[model samples]
Target: MTPEIVEISFKGNKRVPYFNPKEIKVKPGDWVIVEAEKGIDLGQVNKVGRLVALFEIKGDPKNIIRRAVDEDLAKLKENRKEEALAFTVAREKIKKHNLNMKLVDVEYQFDRN
Candidate 1:
């Protein structure tokens, strides 16, 4: 029997499998809150069921904390705004110092921890 796992996609094209111990009903394109290294994170559901089993899971998957709530979504939006501001600031600083670097993307952790 295959384990109940759901693939979640985060920023920076990062994807990871998370264990759905509670069997929370979720489908692709759904937003979910999941366990992060520190507090928690929000990601979009990419795949579920047998398709997820095809991927070689290396370690015990983290738990899907819950389906994203309204509060979580609000936080995500605020984080995006902060990320944009941070990106602009970083680009200005880099140009100020004339460093040979290119700014790509800026992301913020859900909990900001």
Candidate 2:
């Protein structure tokens, strides 16, 4: 299937930034990858939409794209596993190294890809 170019927005402090899905292209029903603050995120397209032109934003909206595909979902799943593993390893390392810092809260994004 031909890949459809779309925009994926992520939550930010001031304004959300859009990501380009150059690695994979997807459809409304398929899962897609989105670059988030914490790490790569997985989401499905709920609607087919385009980026509205905003001169103040600067750059081209063409840089922002989104798509859905199976591989993207699989990769996201693997990334989650890896992230969990990394966290565990980090915790162990911290204890072993006796770091003074205390662990704070961990958050995960559930929507808006």
Candidate 3:
């Protein structure tokens, strides 16, 4: 049988495709752990189903590492909070400096640098 395909959303409006081994059940909006370039990262399942082909995707699909655990969820929440706080601070600074450019988005890097 062919493995099912799943698309998950990552940070910065990025979506990646992964292969579902059919071991764990995941649906849309479900948080899952997926293999990353450096380490495992969290992903929210956006789409799932068998696909004959996809557009502009390179290489084979990866497997879902596992469903995200409580700690993972908590960490995700914390990161989001930090992102919001940073955005607020940056906006305040921009206003103080009277910058005309509009702030679009902010992304928190895992390196913690």
Judging by lDDT against the true structure, name the best candidate. 1
- Which regions in candidate 1 have their CA more than 4 angstroms from the true location? 1-3
Give the alpha carbon lDDT tens digit for every residue of 18-104 in model 2.
434364444444555555555455555433435322313445333323454567656656656665776787788889999987654
Candidates' TM-scores? 0.90, 0.46, 0.67
Alpha-carbon lDDT of model 1: 0.92
Ranking by TM-score: 1, 3, 2
Q: Once superposed on the true structure, which residue ranges of model 3 sit more than 4 Å away at CA?
A: 51-56, 86-104, 109-113
Q: Distance (Å) between predicted and true CA of 6, model 3?
A: 0.8
Query: What Cα-based lDDT does every candidate model obtain?
Result: 0.92, 0.47, 0.79
Candidate 3 C-alpha lDDT tens digits along 38-60: 66678899887754245555897
User: How many clashing residue pairs, candidate 2?
Assistant: 4
Candidate 3 Cα deviation (angstroms), residue 75: 0.7
TM-score of 2: 0.46
The top-ranked prediction according to TM-score is 1
